[model samples]
Target: MQSQDVARRPAPSSPAGPVVEVEQAEAALVEHYPRLVRIAYLVLPSRMGRCRRVLTAHSLTQRALPRARTPAPAIPSRPAGRDGDPGYALVRLQVVRTALEAGLPLRRRAWPKRAQLPSPLPQVWGLKLFPRSGGADELALDQRLSALSGPARAACVLRGLERLPDGDVREVLTAAGVADADAALAEADRGGAEHRLLDSAEFDPCSLQARPTDLLRRRRRLNATLVAGAALAVCGALLGPPGDGWGPDGAAAPPYARNPAAQAALDPGRLTRVSPTAWRTSARVDFSVWPARGDLTDDTALLRRALAVWARPGGSVQVSATPGTPSGGPAGPPQLLYAGTVDNARVVILHDGLRIARYAEPADGTRGAALDFARVDGAGRAGSSAVVLGRTDGNVRYLTAPWVRGAGERDLREPGAAATDIALTGGVTPPLPSPALTSGPCTSWNVLQLTDGTGTRLVTDLGELVPAGLTAGRPGAAEAAAGAEALRTWAPFACSLRAVRSAGVRSVNAWAFAEQPLPDAGGSAAWVCTRAETWRGGGARVLAQFHTPGGRFGAVTARAEDVPACGAREPRVLAGVLWKSGAGTWYLLAAGSRDTVSVRATGGVEGSARGRLLTVRAEQGARADLKGTLEDGRTVSGLR
Candidate 1:
């Protein structure tokens, strides 16, 4: 039965079939295990011990691949056709490589540890061989490897180190070993410009060593100091000094100290006392005395008060002494004597009915004697000039200088004619016209007289006044007539006149006239006039006639425009007459002129008549008519 069962088992297939399958699987896994380990290394580079464990497990799996007892579970079916198996393997390899490049983890142990070892050659070859997985894992692995000393650190860093791109890696390795190889691994995956990537890798180790920790700390301290100093400076500037008082330059001078007291006791205008005898009374008088007897020192108050009594405007005081028997000494009545005080001195007044004398001396020996003389009658006038005892003809003729010898007197008389009793009491002066008044007709007139005995008078005519002057001739007579007709033309409106003269002129031409105030009212009024001759001479001429209330006259020549005119050239001369009183006084009387006529009857036919007469003639021809009363008062006459 065993022979027959064996015959039916189909002549056992070669043992090699299962062995070939195992071998193939082992080969494929071995080919890919390094890449898987690289992935695991990238993912857990900081846990290198774990990565080594994963790599070990992956190696074990590969080894066990060749020892499988039954066909390995159909070698997991692939998505592609059976013919695509090799391609699938290749694709899987590529995927694992990409994962390694992306730094993904894989289930591997010792392989990852082995993969971390550095290669000696330029990394470019290794990079091409396992470009994706090996390059990245190598950098991370190298960073861990850097912890080892010398040869070990060098071995790991340089192993795959040269696989880096072109730039700074070479230079970096020349100076220092890689200290942060993991960062290099990250840079490699990013695929940055090859030179920049390498440059960064190259400088990484040195940069770590070169960083200045102390300098950073110092910079922080400096910043803090600067901020603190700035704050202090600002606080100082704002708060200023701490006390309430003036600074060094008097910036806060006390204002209260500068004001003066309102009621100061010292008298500013009084003179300093020179001697005990020199004294002043409250009445503002200074006086001194000589030949004084008892010292005035103890009695200053009493003396000052005594001086005040006499200093009043209308005070009178007397000094007398006991009468004594007469001796044949001087031929005067009993010599009247009195003791009095003058300033700080004791004084004596010796009086005769006609004269009085004052003598003073300081009670103390400090001052000299003084003497003063005054008339007893009290009629003598006090003056700056020499005091005359009487008029030049008086018997008691004496002249004494006031204080000084030659100070002259000032005359205070006002000038003008003296007023007569009638004029003075009546308050009016009699009117007197000029003896040489112009014959026939006069246009205008003004008169002035003086009040004192100076006897000055002024008279002026009121005609010939012109607007700009006669220099600007009158408008055409027709125009003048028209203007006159347009308004009511009157003789008084023709011109204005004023005259000023001295106390001598007796007669003058009739012209425009005006009366103006005396320059000073105390003086006489000035009568001013402009003569027809002035206009005819082609220039303005003014006569100044001065007159006093006493009826005297004088003449002076002055420019006329300086004198004011009335109606002269004012366009509208309303019906009015201007009258001037005493001086500088004027009034306009609204009145018209009146006319007077005288008539006489001659011996003739007796007649009385009243009728209107008329005659008519051509512009160029002459016509005549006559009418009158005959002696009998009947109508008479005719002409052709």
Candidate 2:
């Protein structure tokens, strides 16, 4: 039959009922389903970057459908190039809003530690990572996108990826709760400018995963804890409890106060994995590599290119090369030594030399070889860092320290027999005016120098280098110095008591740790700080509030009387005092064990407190806890 015959065949109508309306709704949905999923895939903030279009798109569509539908009105269709139908725009906007609100908290809570990317040489920025290349590169791109704050990511996706107009972008961001959509858009634009793909390239659309048959199976599940013959129920804590009440002074505490576990749940990036099961507070990595050469006469062009390949922006590592000789030996064929810093703490010295020798052999055609490595150094800070050395072979090494063989500095081991010309390949060679090969106390920053037949190249670190003198003139060092002085003066307690490394000012953050020795619960009872105040100069004055899963809460304060006198064993405690301005700005003067103390914080509400004292009941190798009340009469106890 002709198409007109099929169109006229619908004259045999069925009785009006829920089934008929549902069938009409399903037909309409099927017609528009692809576009809806595309929009959702671009907009939904899946922290892991998982495909959720099939799940969330349908949910949003069903929500907007009318319950009492009168044979679903025909959708007003438009040209494919235009914004489609006005009705579609309205529904799409609703989906976008729901995606942002529902998916914000679910954003990736932790970044899988990744090595710094090679520098963007010849080009200032790295190549745009293509989703078509589904491997480490794609993971890297996903990581970068996931790092952005919620509103910033939304703006970037809508305006940059989806090519939405400015008006539409603004509306989307504003709906996502961004106060200043313009500023957010600008920031996102700047951040994404360097990473956008070139127009000449193209990629295939990602294949969609299979959809589940039953997506709307809503079932209620409850978790109960039995203690002392009573059941305590925990449910829907992330959405929070019912009431919105104020403290006695009209100050606000978080609504989910009683549930410390929920309060402790921070945005994934803020939580640093301390061990296999524990997390500490910290900032994301901001990576940079500085290329250095002692004198201008040395050829360093090749060195620059090689260093460029190693320096990726916003990576956790700050790798620098220096000219070094083998242990107790003469300058062994000019070597470029390297150092690694993970999260602005712990520095591992590259002891072995990447010996580059002249070989009059043909290019083996093998790309590079990688070797797994481990830390062979001191305690505590040992094995917390990772490094990978790409050699003249094609294989890439995977290294996460503390548990690998060949426990020594990474040697970008040159392929021995199948060798070729090192100079032509831009490998790490020796530099001029050789640097002193000495390992000492951890400093504010570290330096790395690379050299080859082309010339010697100096690489400055993104983080501050130790001894201060080494950081002269390389670029961005003066600002680092100023920030260093600020941190030293404003938060001396942190400088003295907590272990810190010099991170670039752009990525600096404060972490507060209130530790108690709880041998029964693994090793120590460490509480993440829940409040902080940044000083005008540099460092932050932090507030360590102690709260247990068992319903005890208190703040850390400084008081001389509360600390144990010099030799008193039973009352061996550390304490500090806070002086608050009338405006509620608080300053802290603190002291504690020089070796064991460190500061950490995550997702804390910022506020001011007056008449506060930080008293820590601590004994050298015994249990410790935070005690004392704020001027507002909030107290915490029963921490075991």
**CA lDDT of each candidate?**
0.27, 0.29
Q: Candidate 2, 143: how far from true, in Å? A: 4.8
Q: At residue 4, what lDDT does model 2 achieve?
A: 16
Q: Highest TM-score: which candidate?
A: 2
* Candidate 1 structure quality by residue, lDDT tens digits, 74-150: 12223223222332232222222222222212223423322223323222211111122235544544454423322
- Looking at model 1, report the run of 10 residues with the lowest lDDT sum: 464-473
Q: What is the lDDT of residue 295 in candidate 2?
A: 24
- What TM-score against the true fold does each predicted structure earn? 0.12, 0.26
Top model number, lDDT: 2
RMSD in Å for all candidates: 57.0, 27.1
**Candidate 1 residue-pair clash tally:** 88
How many Å off is the CA of 620 in candidate 2?
74
Give the Å shift of residue 57 in candidate 2. Answer: 6.2
lDDT of 2 at 522: 27
Cα lDDT tens digits, model 2, 1-640, are 0111111111212222223254444554556655554454444443322423334444554454435534311222233543344344444444455545444321134331111111122121222111233555444545555555545656766665456777767755554345566776776776663234311112112233232321111110011113312422334342356564232436657655554433222122222122321112223210111111112113233222222222221222222221121112112112222322222111112221221111011111111211111111221111122223221111222122222122111111111112121221112222211111212322222222223222222222221121111111111222221223322222212221112122111122222333443322323323322111111113322233332333222334432221112111221223433323234443332223222232211122212222222322222323223343422344423121
